[model samples]
Target: MRSNRDRAILALAVSTAARASELLGLRGADLDWGDQLAQVRRKGSGAQQWLPASAESFVWLRLYLEDLGPLGPDAPVWWTLRRRERSGDVLERRPLTYDALRAVLRRANTALGTNWTMHDLRHTSALRMVRSQRLSLRDVQVVLGHAHLTTTQIYLVEDDQEILRRVHQYLADQAEPSQEAVASESTVGYDSNDLAVLLGGVPR
Candidate 1:
């Protein structure tokens, strides 16, 4: 059960794809616990995100802090359950650090056979936006805090699976046509000359 806590943390980190610094910078108070949305500051660009917390994370955090009672507004969000030191001696109260987070992720990868790095989590987040959510590049740029849309563009992956999915959808839609359905849809009719106007020349 305790091991699952560690696994859950690892899952959340990769799925969120937030920088270690940004993830560590999160505060408990930033969460709307009931709604599972959190306000986070991206590390380099300083952009803020309204990230949706995973249901598991929300539940775990609530249970972990239940005995500690309510936290202050500026309290450190992630706790080490120990003090920082040259040696890994435990401290009672201290904020979780990036170094510690790195160690946690390393263990998680070893256990799961998932060759993931800290930044790969961020990449995973970007991939999730593309695959699962089908978010626009513009939306990804805002969420990932890329300084330029070009930076975000590098992560756009159009894999064979996506091509197949699109092709299947196209074929399915083509196979299921009805005149009544077409009639109910709005039409933007174009003259044959529209193509020439668009191309700025006659078709070769």
Candidate 2:
């Protein structure tokens, strides 16, 4: 079973495409339940931007918040769970650090047998929005808060296999009309040599 923290990490990464530091910096006040938006601090500009939270992300976040119990607005959204030594098995809550987040991701990667960094999840989200969801590049740029369209273009690269499939489809479409024409003409007493000439070939 996945922990609340783990679920929140994955959901926010894929849904919001927020950087690790930005995500770690999130407080309870940043999430607006009614608006379905999370206010994140942009990296370079340090400007605050609002990102839409997906329904799936909202569900997971709500479950996590319930487990987290009531907290003040200034309290961190993601808290580090620490075991208490004095108390007979009580978990203490503290602000989750970047290092702690990395450790959590590392453990998750080991369990899943895949090497995925936080940024990888961001890229995956970008590609999914562009390719699978068929969203515009400008839309993705807004979601990712990219300053330039060129940066968003990097994420729009099509897969080689998909490109090849399209090429094959085009070639098949071009050949079909010519093949049908040749078949129809051949039924009118045209020999192989005449058919070859009709198809732009010199008779042998």
**lDDT of candidate 2 over 21-59, digit per residue (tens):** 888878889998898888889998989999987877878
lDDT of 1 by residue, 110-194 (tens): 8788877778877877887866666788877877777799998888788898799999999998899878778767455655577
Name model 1 segments beyond 4 Å from true.
1-8, 11-15, 67-69, 83-91, 132-134, 168-204
The per-model lDDT (C-alpha) reads 0.72, 0.85
Model 1 local distance difference test score: 0.72
Cα RMSD (Å) between model 1 and the true structure?
Answer: 10.7
lDDT of 1 at 204: 39
Error of 1 at 192 (Å): 35
Show the colliding residue pairs in model 2: none
Measured with C-alpha atoms, the lDDT of residue 178 in candidate 2 is 81
Q: How close is every model to the real structure, measured as TM-score?
A: 0.69, 0.75
**True-vs-predicted CA distance for residue 26, candidate 1, Å:** 1.5
